[model samples]
Target: MTSHADQPNVARTLTGQSGGEIPRDDWSAGRGRLFLLLVAPSVLLLVLLNAYPVFYAALQSVRNGTLISPGEFVGLSNFAKVLQSPDFWHSVRFTAIFTVSGVAGSWLIGMALALLLRAGVYGGGTVKVLLLLPWVVPIVVSSMAWNWLVATPDSPMPTLARMLGFETPLFLADPLLAAITVCVFKVWCSFPFMMLIMSAALSGIDRSVYEAASIDGATGWQRLRYITLPLTARTTYISWILMTIFCVNDFPTIYLLTAGGPIDATTSLIVLAYRLVFQNFQTGPGVAIALMMTAAMVVVSLILFRQIRKSGGPA
Candidate 1:
């Protein structure tokens, strides 16, 4: 429908050449300005939400005192004290145990479930949705449900244990049992996330590779060990790193369940920080502990980022 006279303008626009009806440089400048205007508010909000508290916390960490007095700039004494504390080390040990156990348990279960589903289990869609229910539920609600199931003497778990002839059924009262219980709870809530990721990774893998391997006389176990795990190794590592951070920073689950009870057996660093600041009124040490945890997380995140890049994951 274009006439010969109007063809030049249409051709220029189609080729991204803006000189016919608009100057090319001016159009580009306008687009750049529009992009900046649209993005600036979000950038500003992100800085305020994330950076400001970090700076404030850093400043607070150096000052010694209760929250009100904030005594004086102690020049890392707070951090030194925290590092030297037996209680801090105890919490650190438990935190490591909790994080490792949770990450490993969740990942294993998730991968297993993924494999089962990948093999085309009956009712796979329904099962997948059911598995995610725990995760979708509020943490407080989930913690309370778990508490009801195990914490009390007349609880179903204890009642079942008593009926089964076990004398002591205080699952949350014993130190080792408490630690295990928390780890199990963490796995229960976390496995769905891992399953979703592993499933996606498995799906992306070309089935033809497995077909080829099988044609070459690869058995079921052999294909799994050689093909599946290797192909999904990067995703598995990513899941581990992510779940490690989640377990490390998790507070609500432990707090609502145990409150670090039974001699501080389930106390993670986050719980310890909360206790120091709010319960003990030691703001300086609390902030220092938090900052130390932040530093540790940063180190772990950097390692993970490097690995992700090496594995060709998104930046």
Candidate 2:
């Protein structure tokens, strides 16, 4: 549709010579305005909902005495108390175990499932749905269900143990056993999320790489080590970081199930904070403990994200 005179003009070309009117990019300003308009409410809401609470918590942590009717500001006294508490250290130790075990177990199982799904086994879709069901259920409901299955001697597992010539297992009764049970329960509930993310990472790998590795006589374990592991290293690290946060901050899984006991054996930092604030009515130390957890989370997340930046792809 161009005229012959216009066709000969260099300004009409994509290179934008000065012989004709240049196209205006007016949308850039409009887009910036629109973006701010759309994002402002969310930013405001985060400030109100998230940032305000954190700031308030920090303020509360420095204040002495109860939740309401604040006493004199005692800088770092609450944190010093929390740091010196034996119960706090116990909670921290168990929390570390629970986080490490739950993250490792879930990631290994999830990555295995992702690999199986990527290999396109029979009924993969159905299996994926079934695997997702545990995570899809409400935590309260799942925790209650697990309690029924394992918390009592009359439960199915204990009954089965009796039949197998073993004593009725007290999953939540003994300290060591309770720790193991809570960690396993957390893994069971958390693995489906890991599976979902790992599946996405697995799909992005080029099949040609694996084929070439196979032709070069790479064994199954070698391919897994040199190709799959290296490729998905970043994703694995990210998954571990997220799951650690979930496991550390978890309250319902421990409270609803064990209430941080078999004599306080399963108390995590979150549960300890709740017990201090609500049960013991020590708001200052409680908030200080919570802030400590937040600091730990920020440190861990930054380290993991740095690793991700260093890696080029899924790895």
The lDDT of model 2 is 0.89
TM-score for each predicted model, relative to the true structure: 0.90, 0.89
Tens digit of per-residue lDDT, candidate 2, span 212-262: 999999999999999998898888888878898998898988888889999
Displacement of residue 253 (Cα, Å) in model 1 is 0.8
Badly placed stretches (over 4 Å) of model 2 are 1-27, 313-315
Candidate 1 per-residue lDDT over residues 244-294, each given as its tens digit: 889999999898889997899989899999999899988889999999988
CA lDDT of every candidate: 0.89, 0.89
Candidate 2: the clashing residue pairs are: none
